[model samples]
Each structure stands twice: as structure tokens, then as C-alpha cells.
Target: MTERSKEQEQGGQVRELLATRADEVSLPDGWADRVLRDGKRAVGRRRLAATTAAVAAVAAVGVLLSGLPGTGEQPPASRPEWATADSVPQALRKMPVGPDTDVPYGTRGEQGKGALRVMLGGRAIPIPKEYTGLRIWRAGDRGFVYLADGPGDVSVVVHVDADGTSTELERTAKGEHTTQLNVSEDGRFAAWTVHPYEGRSQVVKRADLTTGKVGSRSYDDIDSVHGFAGDDVLINWDARVQNIGSLDRDGTPWPSADRDGGVEDYSVASDTVLLSTSDGCMRAYSIAQPDNQRWKVCDMEDVHFSPDGQRFVALREGGYVVSDTSSGEVTGGLWSVPSVHPQDMAWEDDDTVLLELAEAKPARTKDGMIAPIAPQYGPSYLVRCHVEQERCELVDTGGPVKAFPSSSS
Candidate 1:
């Protein structure tokens, strides 16, 4: 059957999946490398600045030169191939722009300062202070629901109406460093990890957004909550094992979603699961029938599925590719410079996506030459790409925006 016909056959299930897919977003890739490189650079700068006063001026200049692009300190970022103004590809022409209406998008405080902001009704609505980590999804016509991390490991689950009214719900503590908040696409359920002191296993807490009632299930080895597939919660079983499994709403273990290997992603909307293995390949499977494989790709990593489950973006060696989910057809691909990589992607609308290009820290090679870029570094840029038009433009969201994609919160 044609992919279109197969999609149509799914009917309401597909629609429901797409609706929830809006809330699904990929986390920043290479986060560890970025943090490590950033830390090293920061220390080097600090030590240089603290040098003897006689050489302070020279050291300051040296620091400045070290950070400048193409100065042997770091490689210059090259423009994405598909975004080049001089060479437009036919495959990207006449691309659909998806929906025109505004959706609630997520943003962090500049430099992770201030409160997390949500752009809604043409204005930025700031969430509560000390923004730890946050996830947002539309609350039907009422406005948006935010699952935010507050000061002191507090989990803030609140709903904001269209008129700017905020109604906060009560939930258990979200334990320290618990930043990821996964919500169902319909905004009906939210899941997070709760680590109590002296506990044997962390508890995965599921909160009902509508009734404000909370349910808890304890697992001996849950590394984190992946997300919700329908009302079932997906979890990363153990850090070492890297197993993916599911749990019922009441927190009972459900092996139906069980799979080995790290999770590339789990589409809560479509109940589709993507897993990556050691051989450097990824495969998509139905969450319901775990054995039912949908598609698989080799030598690809960092997969992010679109909200409609029609397409996905994945990173290859030189750059990234956008592909059909069912058939694994390569729809479009872009060549990227070695200095930068497409670290993250989020669906801005139906046809447009936001890509974050991250710079890597330059290292010294043999013969006293500087090494090329690696996929590590913070403070990345946001580029919005139109899938059909095959065109991408750098997105400037007023001030400095975080490297993460702005989800429909």
C-alpha cells in the first residue's frame, strides 16, 4: 500500500497521534561533550585572565583570538547546504509551511537566566523563577499546560488559560536535578521521576492533568522517563542495560513496550518507538506490537520524528537527512561543514522545523595543527528550515535563545 493510503487507514488514531506529537521533542544531542568542552574553555579563559599584570593586556588579546572563528581555536561554522541562497534545490521548492496560527513555543531565560518563557497570544509569558527544566503542551482552547521544575526539586504543574490566568496544581516533589517533564500530546497526563531520600528505587510519578490526581509506580532501575505512549509511561530501565520499557498508568510494569538499546525517541502521539543499538543503526517499532518493525536505517543517529509521524530527521556522517517514516525514503538531505552539526530538531509547524547548529571545541593535532570541530559546545544558533522549500533561515528570537528547540508548550 502507498504510504498515504496507509496513513489514511489509521484514521483517528493517526490524528490523535499527530496531536500529541506536537509535545514530543528531542533533547539536546552531545550534551555531555558540550558541557565538557565549555567547562574546559571557561577554565582556560579564567586562568589566562588571572595571569601576571604585566602580560594582562596580551593575555586578554590572546583569549579574544582563541574564541574567534577560524583562528585555530575553533572552526568557522559553514552555512547549511540546503539553506544556501545561491544554490536552491528543486526538491525543497514549493514546500508547505504547515499551519499559520501561532502555537505556544518554549524558550529559556537568556543564558538560562530569569524564568522560562512561553510565547502565546503574541506575548511572552514567563514561568515561575529559577527555571530548572520545563515542558509545555497546548491545553486545548484553554491555553497551555506547563510542567516545570522549580527551586528545591519542586515540580510545578500549572495550566494557563487564554486570558493569562494561571492555575497551579499540586504534585509531589520532583527530586533534585529532575528537569525533564514528559506530557501526553493531549496534555492529559504528565510523567516525571521522583527520587526520595534513602529510597531503593526511584518512583515514576504520573499526574492526571485534568483531575489533579497523581499516581506513582516504583521501579528498581529506572534511569529516566522517556514519555507517555497513550497513558502508558515509557522509561529508560537502567543506565548500563539501556533498556526501554513501559508501565501502566498505575505504574505496573508493562513489558509490551520493552526493547533493548537506548531510546532514539518514543512518539507519544503515534505510539511509535525508535531505538538505537551499538552497530550505529536505528529502528522504529510499534509500541503496541513491539515485534512489528516499521522501518530501520543504518549508520544514522540522533533521530527526531515529526509530529505527524510522516517524516523524521537524522544525522549521518557529514550532515543530516529528512526521511519518510514508513518507507524510510530519503526525502531530502543536507551537507554540513565539519565544524558544526545539526544537534537538535523540533517541528515548528507541519512543514517547517527548527535546527540547532552547535560548534565544537578545536583541539591540537600532530604537527602542531588545530583539529577540526567535534559535535560539542553550547550557545548554538537556531535555524528554521522549510521542508518543502528546502530553505532554512537563522531564527533570532529577540535575544539569545538556548540551543534546544522551542516546543509547542
Candidate 2:
């Protein structure tokens, strides 16, 4: 009779979701206006800076006083009533302080430089040459290069002795697949989900900068870990066998075995698994469990947490659902994406979800004949129906390619 029991009895719906076209969705009001305002402010700054020389001749300290058109008039970033920065777990706030590189988190590479860069507070410091998909990880007296080579292989290289130069320390074997990559908060260690071809399918590994030694922490019988908390790594392998466990910097195992659960797919924030799934549906899980596990299922359809784990959003019939997980409630949809995370979703902001929809596009490649063409990303929706708002809106990103979450590999 109850939803939980109903889920237990039938194993819930194992149905695959359907995708749709993009043009059907509508953009919310003020969305474009807001972006336009930001653009104008940026343009105004260039004009002001150029005129500084002339302004000095005409007036006294006047250039600094110009304040631009909407400088003071712009509204503060709208923080949703339910989304509080403090409400987020402490681990997220624990990301460390270190030297930065000019690489963007998910970018492959650009302008002869690697796409990856070291970032903090949204500011990115270039990681030297921006190559495509190169993630820059900072370690004490070293800089490590990580590539989000999908759910398959990953590349790791180290740069030593800050002449702003580098060297390739090691390149893992081809058969090994990397799932999770955690950069230590202290910038002294790195943890990765290493699936070596010869031995166990996957294991947690830690690399120490000082000794140049990489070794396994104890193995949790799971597919891979979601992420790390501080220097502690969290492992989750199977829907039924998966458990959340911790590994210290020295590769020491935390006392608790792991939080047992049926997790089909999930995502992690600094210390918590903000999104989790079982055979039935994807729900938000809490990291505060006594044994370190607790997940509450919502009525949301195809639900997931944001890449930053600051918000909860989902897709349902003709609408989407965005909710606050800390509280057992629905924030409803910000707007309909005409889809939600259809194939994969990317967060454009706190208010919108970028849906990568699936559609049958005729392809010329030979692989298309055997496999259903991997769906392409459609558009970025500036939704409001997200989180139970009065109405929902949408924005078109005009995409038709594979995409992933910003902070997620």
C-alpha cells in the first residue's frame, strides 16, 4: 500500500526513459534580460578602462567614481529560500588551499593549453599549456595531470620543482579503468579507482608525493568509489553490495566496514553521496548516517543532485522536480526541459539544468549501424519550475553532442 513497500514488492519500474525534441520548451521571463545585463556590465568595464587616461586629464579621481550602469543596481545572487550554503556538508567547504593553474575543471584544452585548470572560489589559474580534457591537480611540490577519460581509462603525469615545467612520472596501463579521482585537501595525496586488468576489477589507490610510492588501501568489494572526504576516500561498488567506506592518507582503513546499500548510480559532494539509486529510483542519500548511511526516496522521477550538490532536481511527466533533500519536500520544477538529464545533465546554474537529450539522428559513422547512436546534448534550460516554484520555464542550449556534469568526470 505504501510507496516503500510497493517498491519492495515489485522491484519498482525498470522502464527506460524516452527523449524529446528541444524547440517545444519555452524560456522564462527575465532570464535573457538577466544575461543581457551581465553582458552590458562586462562591456561597460572595457569602455571605462580605456577612457581612464583621458578621464584623469579632465577630472580628479573621476574614473574610479563612474560605478558603471548597473554596478550598484544589480540584485544580489538570488539564493533559494531552501538552499543554504551552510546547509551543505562541512566536507564540501573543506576543499583546500594551494597553488592554482589556469585550467577549467571540465575543459579538454584550449588555445594550446590544456582544458583543465586548478580552481577555487570560481576563479581558475591556468595550468600552463591548456590541452583538451587535462585536469590539473595540485600536490605538495608537484602538479599532477588527470584526464577525465570517461568511465574508461585515465591519464596521470606529474610536474615537479616549479620552474612552471614538467615530466611524465607514469602512464597507467591501457586495460585499467579509472572511476574516481580525489585530490587531497592538503594537496599531499591523490586517490583513484584503479581497475587493473590482471587482478581485482577495481581497488582504491593512494599516491604519496614524498616517497613517490603508490599503493592500495584496503579493497572494498565494490565497482569504484564515489569520491573522498578530506583525505578520506569513499567507496561504492554495486547496487546491492555497495557500501561507503573510508581510507586515510597512509592507506589506512577506517574502522567502519562500509554502509551497505543497493546503489545503481550516484554522485558525491566533498563528503556526502548527494545522489544515489537502487533498482527502483535515484534518491538523495545522507552522509550523516550513524553507521554512515541514510537515503530518503522522493516522488521525483529520474531525480539527481547538482554537480556541486547544492540542489536537487528531477524529471517527471511533462514537468521536472527540484527539491531540498535535507527536508522531506518537493521544490517542484523550475521549468520543463522537455526532458531532464535525458541522457546526461549538466547544471547551468542553481536554477537551471542542462539536459543532454537522446534522439535518432542519422549518422554516417560505421559504429552507428551497430549501436544506437549515443544521444546528444540538446539545450540548457533556465528553469524555474525547479523546486516547486509557481511556474516552470526553459532555455535552449542548441546542443547535439555528448556532455557531462561540470564538476563530474
Candidate 3:
């Protein structure tokens, strides 16, 4: 099968790790200035990359942020500063490291009843009972943007900070089906697709987590929502024609990558876009200077850029490879069970990856072909793989894995 079709087939099994899926939308005015302000407010540099997580076909809600909206074209006065946008290197260098925290994790069922049963740093974070079946994405060091199913047809969007203070950012409007929440790498903005029951058009809504302002644009046809680039939202529209564009915050649209190319993933740190060529090749391009190509790969499939934008992980040659983003050279490898099928892959941190895989044991059949001993395994597992060490440790073994270590099993 073709690479694109293979990735799509795998995408079904890889639901939990589909956070790297791309969609695009709009950002507000003074995006660069806002990014600069956030950078200045940063205290110390942290290497961890904040990324959004998404589940297949699930909808989330948009909500209120803490700050006041900016007046005129100037940056908002009340928005919290998080990172820089002056330069890619400086942005990565200046990213603030907040309180000690690990990526939130829990077994599959924990998202159902007893929501917020997720463990951070080995402690159970208490979540409100109303916020059931929570799907969380890392925001700031001590913060997260989450979507939870509320009473009735309601789904609420919320932000939780380092102090464990929960802020309701948004809740779904009546008769609205909100797509999964996608957060910027710096945790300053959240974007999602909204299908209102009253209309046939799709609306992409973006919430400024700092200014508490939400921006939206309507389109007759939207294929998918990519994540973010700096503050610009990436989107793919006109599926049949494959039109792609980077949407600005103030309703202005930025130059997009090749129209015929499909966006594979994005890196906010470098403002880079990884795209798939119409003919099935992959390349990385700069969103600011569309002509400035960073790297290209003709054979890679299911590419995921690291949180820092310096590296990426992809399934290549039937194995997982970590390659440098600048040169597209394989730098390291990840452990995987050939007998097991991976459903999804999420970056636990800059140097680590979390993979959801079908738990299976390899067996040799009469034909000497290696296959799973059984037709099915009980439940999938989240395996933590270290990039540099080339090793993997099981995180979900049908129970909590001890405080969910920050760097170790």
C-alpha cells in the first residue's frame, strides 16, 4: 500500500498517540509581540516540550482563559508571558521550566468515571466529578489544557496551573460538536473545529489562554486541523483540491506551504511545517519563509516532530527511528516489539516517547512466520521509550506505574 494509506490504516490503532495530528485555524493580533512577552516572563529554561494530544473523532470544548483581551493592535496587558518568538534558537533556549512535573498519565479506563484520576509526579491529581472522561494535553510546566464530558451533551474545556488551580476556559455551546482541543507548543492558545447543529459550515475556534479571547473563522470545507506554528494556526481545507494555509490571529492568512502538499506535523519552537508531497514524499519548510526548506525525506511515514523541534520520530524500515530535523539523519532508535502493533505514539518529554501498543507475544507458526500467539491481547499498553538509551519500559501494566516518574521507570 502507499505510505499515506498505510499511515491512515495505522492511525486507527494509534488513536491515543494521535496528538501529533495536524489541523489549522487562526491566531490573534500581535502574535509575535505576544510571544516575545511570554518569553520575557519565562524564569528558567526547561527542556521539556509542551504538546497537544488528540483522540480520533472526539470533540472537545473551548473555554475562558485568565487574562484580559488586548486593546487595539498592542499586546494584551493581562496575558501571562510564557516563551519567545524572536528567533527559533532563542525561543528554544529561553523556554521557561516551571515546577517539577511529568506528563500526566493513566490507564485507558481512568478517562471514564473518576476522571482526573491521572497521576503526576506519583500523586493522584484530584479532579471535579463533573469533569468525567478527561483527555489532557500538557500546557506549561505545571499546567494542562483538558477536555471533559460534562452533564448531558456538554463538554467543558479547562486549564490547570502549577498550583493545581483549575480555570474553566470554555464549555461547548448548545448543539455544538467541538473537535479535540489543540494547544500551542507554549500553551498560550487552544484551537479546535466546531460543527454547530444549526449550520452546515464548520467553524475553527481559537482561544487565547492568556487573554481569554477566542477567535473563529467559518469555512464551507475544512479537511483537518493541524496544530500551531508560533501563534499561527495551521489548517487544511478544500480536501479535493488539497489547499493548505497558515491562519493568522487577526483574520489575516499567512503564506502556506505547497498547496499540493499535505501538512504532516508542525513545530512551534522553530515555526516549521512538515508536509507530505502530493506524490508521497515528505519535507520540512519554514512557515515564515516558505521557500526556506529545512529538510526533506522521500520515504519516511508517520513523522512526528519532537517537542523541541530539533528532532523527529518516525516509523521507518519496520522500526522506529529518531532523526535530526535539520539534516533528516537518523540519530537514534527506539525499542519496539515486532509482534505488537503500535496504536499511537506521544512524546512524554524531549528525550522520551510514549507508545500505545497491542500487548502481544511473538510466536512462530508452522510456516515459520512470526505472529502474535493470540488473535487479541487483553488491553493495549503505554510503553515509555527513551530516545538516547534505545530502551523501552512498560508504563501501563493494568495498574498505576508508581507516581509516574519524571525521568525514570
Work out the TM-score per prediction. Answer: 0.59, 0.46, 0.59
Tens-place lDDT digits, model 1, residues 55-161 = 32233224334454211122112223322332222211212111112456655655436666876656677776675566666554556767666766566667776
* Tens-digit lDDT string for candidate 3 (1-409): 8765765555444343222221211234333333333322311111212221112112110111222211111223322132122211232223222222266654323423344465555465676666566677766564666777778777787766656667777777778755456777777777767666665437777777776677777777665565665666665554221222233333334445344554544333465666665657776766566667777777777766677778877776655678887788877666333555555566767887766555444566899787765544324445566565333444423332211211110
Candidate 1 — which pairs collide? 17-269, 20-185, 34-377, 92-388, 92-389, 95-388, 95-389, 136-409, 137-409
Off by more than 4 A, model 3: 1-101, 108-116, 126-133, 197-201, 211-213, 217-220, 239-254, 261-269, 317-319, 360-377, 395-409
Whole-model lDDT per candidate: 0.52, 0.39, 0.52
Model 3 residue 339 lDDT? 57
Model 2 reaches what TM-score against the true structure? 0.46
What TM-score does candidate 3 get on C-alpha atoms?
0.59
Residue ranges of candidate 1 with Cα displaced over 4 Å: 1-116, 132-149, 153-163, 167-177, 197-201, 238-271, 334-340, 358-379, 403-409
Off by over 4 Å in 2: 1-145, 148-154, 157-170, 182-190, 198-202, 207-215, 218-221, 238-261, 269-275, 283-285, 290-295, 298-310, 314-320, 339-409
How far does residue 147 in candidate 3 sit from its true spot (Å)?
2.2
